[model samples]
Target: MSLGAEETHHGSLKPHDSLFRDAEKVSHSTHRGSQVSWMQTLSLAFQSIGIIYGDIGTSPLYVYSSTFPDGIKNNDDLLGVLSLILYTLVLIPMFKYVFIVLYANDNGDGGTFALYSLISRYAKIRMIPDQSAEDAAVSNYHIEAPNSQLARAQWVKQKLESSNVAKIMLFTLTILGTSMVIGDGSLTPAISVLSAVSGIREKAPSLTQSQVVLISVAVLFVLFSVQRFGTDKVGYTFAPVISVWFMMIAGIGMYNLVIHDIGVLRAFNPMYIVQYFARKGKDGWVSLGGIVLCVTGTEGMFADLGHFNIRAVQISFNGILFPSVALCYIGQAAYLTKFPENVADTFYKSIPAPLFWPTFIIAILAAIIASQAMLSGAFAILSKAQSLGCMPRVRVIHTSHKYEGQVYIPEVNLVMGLASIIVTVAFKTTNDIGNAYGICVVTTFSITTHLMTVVMLLIWKKHVIFIMMFYVVFGSVEVIYLSSILSKFTQGGYLPLAFALVVMSLMVTWHYVQVKRYWYELDHIVHIDEMTALLENNDVRRIPGVGLLYTELVQGIPPIFPRLINKIPLVHSIFMFMSIKHLPISRVVPEERFLFGRVGRKEHRMFRCVARYGYSDTLEDPKEFAAFLVDRLKMFIQEDSEVTAQNEPAERDNSSKEVPEAQARLTQTTVEEEKQLIDREVQRGMVYLMGEANVTAKAKSSVLKKIVVNYVYTFLRKNLTEGHKALAIPKDQLLKVGITYEI
Candidate 1:
């Protein structure tokens, strides 16, 4: 496929040149080292897919057995189930995922961050677009910052950039995705293990039930132990493993249909659904209790978007997975109808006892793989979230390809591990746990459809009518699924539902707290046009000297403009500047570095400046980024220091000069020396806000003690990780409110 002039090919060398920075000593940055082979790349992708698809694959263990009303509905109803399966695997995964989601990847990175990066490039990023930057650039005519395609794109993409609005939206989506997934992750293993163990009982009619329990425990333990290996290996085998699974099911289903002959054809008819519902009425609505179980893994498919190319997943579905599932359901229906008295355990009894144990083992293997898929995807997503600051960073090891995001989290493993074990012990088997699985899966699937709806409308700009048509179809299917799953509420289903609710709540709360803290930090650095004027009019303290602050986000303007204006407008007097460079997540690759752009402007002397980063930086220190600005800033205009040997600045107002000659200087100093210097006054800005305390803000606030708090809070929020939240929890218990005022 051809790419646009502005769009680089997916395999283009030095892809991040237009972006901010290359990876900087990041744990798993792929751009840092030796080039990998195509085979290696394929391996990585496959592993990622495996880790992510585990839950979806194992759904067959219950979906076919559970989708219809008890005692066989016939051919017609079976066809509908088959149709749904076909469309789900073939159409949805193909169109929405393979064609769209995978193509939407930003620099090979997927998830909200990939979308955020792409959109951030084009969205308008300033708090407001029209402001003071034009004159300032005009004044510092020699300070060459261009309005390049990259610069314009950054603002254009600001709709979901690194801002409060974007973070919140992403957080909401992640919570929805993770909650349902965690719900399934906890239950899939138990069901798979239990199902496998129970099959052994059929072979040895008198086999002690204790053996089943022992087998389950042993298998679960082994599954848990192998998690660190990642999903790649299992992912390769998934297509094949699941291929056997479907074949076995289809063979059984087809055999049953043949035995039942003409009567079996009735099962393929839709009338069975209508007639069954007509007679059962409320009872059929109640039978819907099981119909939803058929689609338990849909949401997990969405959550695993980053793990596999949409095409691969869709191919797996349409080419093979869906047909087998349909056959299995139809077969189950035929067998039950042919011999009504033998409805119970029909899926197993129809087959030989020898085959039952093997099927059980295969099913269990499929389950462990499903669980691994979820586990790894979670690790990857959380890793990206940490770097993006949606969540605090945790210690993560890369167990797969060095994508920086293909991570291993011991803590996450432990938590999920312990919880899954507890749940398995509580529920005991697949039949018991199946109820909870569908509820979480369907609920999350419904939410993904909603998110996909938004993506189509805003991002893709699809027509409203077209979007709605798809929405209605998908939504109806989900509603049907959801209604049936609701029956699970009375069963073990409440566990996953409650688990989802709790996980979502915590994710939302953390996002809220992150936003609040961001606002407080903004209060420290910003100066509003109106508020600063009012302060100046009222004889408020004069902010001294031009102060510049370095910020983490690479954008047109800081997101917390309101808090910035509210807290610091009158606190300083000099031309204040806030600067951020677009930093990429990969290592420096040379051709992509060295940027020049100006995005936003406020009244007085405050200006927004951005610089893009090059790729070779994985080995280089990023602080040198600020140093680069200082070097380039020297060309802004003849330095006032050069113009007036003694007191040039007193009369040389910035209005006369084209650009404020930011005096940021970088000196090569040892860590202890740099720390000591910052200990006195940490460097406040990237270009010239060198040193700790903002000399301007400090002079403005003579109270002294107040400045200390601001500095401390800034220091901690930037440096602290999520693990620190546990420390703050105790303080919150002692105090009714959250940790708003950092000591």
Candidate 2:
């Protein structure tokens, strides 16, 4: 069964409420109620930024340290640390993410597929606007346009066509993301919870380490347990807490930045990044890979595209997001210079001793909150994918109608919970998981970069200089991140990749299996010409042989092409084949089902016809459509009024009673009656259940066919609806199938 879009019907409304509403066109808030000032939007954006952008937002802790270990070994590399921090926060986040991907966000949704759909749709329209516009442009310009509108139009059309390849790539990324994020999903709560619990150990020196893990486990159990209570409510509370957390990091960052002047200001320079790669050689690029740790959560932007408004995300990133990240990282670089001999993580360790434990607990809580973005993101992507026919339907509960993206899956949550705890147990430290984290996200980001490059070249009329420079910078950054994680695979990073492989393989297999089954069914179509020929002037109980329908036909020869001629002719003779050749771009309509016949012209013995639906009619289902055609044909042959006009004139000589009898017979044509008889015959095969109709398999091949049919029936039963199964005797009688009645 196909998973179509939900109708989302509304039933009733409360007092002073309308159930029917348009969220995009109709404003929810009254103009008199509030203006939603920029500062207020910024404040809301800050809160949302904390919730949506926490992963990348928290990167200052580890990324700079990971990058500038060489600087730490020496006392004076604060410049290098500052440089890396500046480029990462002020450049990467500011220029690359905030200015680019966010701007490319599709129709307020940000992700590869959403952007793909948006750019493709709009690009095509803009490419070939109209003749009046083309002429007006020519008059306005002294020179001809550089590119033909039609050429650009074809280029985009081809790109959109190539998008199936892009979809597969995106689906690959989705699975990769779900696996890694799920892995992170499991570890986040455990590490965050245990670290928080561990903070108490400093306050209470006698507490055992086992007690910490146990309490951590208990907190995780509870945290995992309550996800069914939608995150929308929790996020409202969590977002503000997270924002304060960012502010804390910001305060500490500025604290370190104000006093230290080891070229701390120069960290804002982009040349530091250029020099880091240039002077340090390949090791510099390799080490700089850890810089991805800062933007690791960038992919979360794509994953969580469905959750927040694109405008809100933009406001958050350029305004609250980048500035806070810049401050924290600068603080971290400054902290290292003063305490090179012994450094704790700059995020927590930068704070004074008096506030250490409290801040540590706060940091851990922030990480748990960070986990929420990915957890919620995975649920949203999977749910939307299922609705779009790219995934299987899992049981999903939409927890917040106000926020359609906030969904809960008991199965998904439970699995994430298990995977997260296992990760905490496996790695035993935040550093270990940190290395594990960036690999999945950066790979996905890299793939998106590649996808967007294709989109730009084929869809957007972007300048070559811009595109070349864009790829060089972005691709190099992604390659650095990927290489950095290669060191971690031997430790624990490969687990997510290995897990992702399993999921990607499963998705590919299911899609192929469905395609095979559908094509086989489509190939067996019986043409109307063949059916008409099968029924010529015969009064017979059975055809006494299986019907053979040929699919392929050669040109001309009255379309009694070789395949049709060979298979549908003179054997048992009551056979048909419908050849439907569809153009990849055209729609197939019912009125196009017509015959091109040779053999059937003389005696209506065998026939061939075509159903003119094109390849683009991708939404049509084989079995359901076949059933629909049967119903329409039944009405047309048995009771349609048109046959009365021609036949009633000749039969007027008969008496009124005789004329009525002939009319009844003509209304129910032999071809329509024969189809019903064949359907009944197939249904009668079910009698093998009760030991009736026990005729032995005749041909050597029929034995395998019978067994295959039996297996198919069993599998089909599992996939069908209860109502559909009820119409079949197998489930109704509950006697034919091997399964027992469980009353």
Indicate which candidate wins on lDDT: 2
Off by over 4 Å in 2: 1-47, 64-71, 116-153, 159-216, 259-263, 270-286, 387-390, 525-743
The lDDT, on a scale of 0 to 1, for candidate 2 is 0.51
Candidate 2 residue pairs in backbone clash: 82-267, 186-420, 187-420, 533-604, 588-613
Candidate 2, residues 601-699, lDDT tens digits: the string is 423333222343321122234445345534443333332233334435553554467776676576556645655654664344311112111112224
The TM-score between candidate 2 and the true structure equals: 0.62
Candidate 1 lDDT, 1-743, residue by residue in tens:
00100111111112222121222222232221125555554544444344444455555555545544264545444444443454455445455555555544433345444444333333432222211221111111111112233433334245455576764564466556666665665666666566556666666768655667667777777777777776554446865675676677677668766876436444444555566565556655655545555555544454454444444445555555556666666566566555644443555666645576677777676766666656666665555444333344355566655433345766666666766677667765555567776676667656656655654544555555777877897788678767766766776767877887776655544444444444444444333334335445654454443334444323323334333444444334333233323232322233223323322221233333433321111212344544553443332212222322233345556575532333322121222342343223223322233112111123444454344335433444455443323212222222111223221
List TM-scores for all candidates, in order. Answer: 0.62, 0.62
In order, the Cα lDDT scores of the candidates are 0.48, 0.51
Which ranges in model 1 have alpha carbons more than 4 Å from their true place? 1-54, 64-171, 205-214, 231-239, 259-271, 300-308, 339-346, 402-405, 526-743
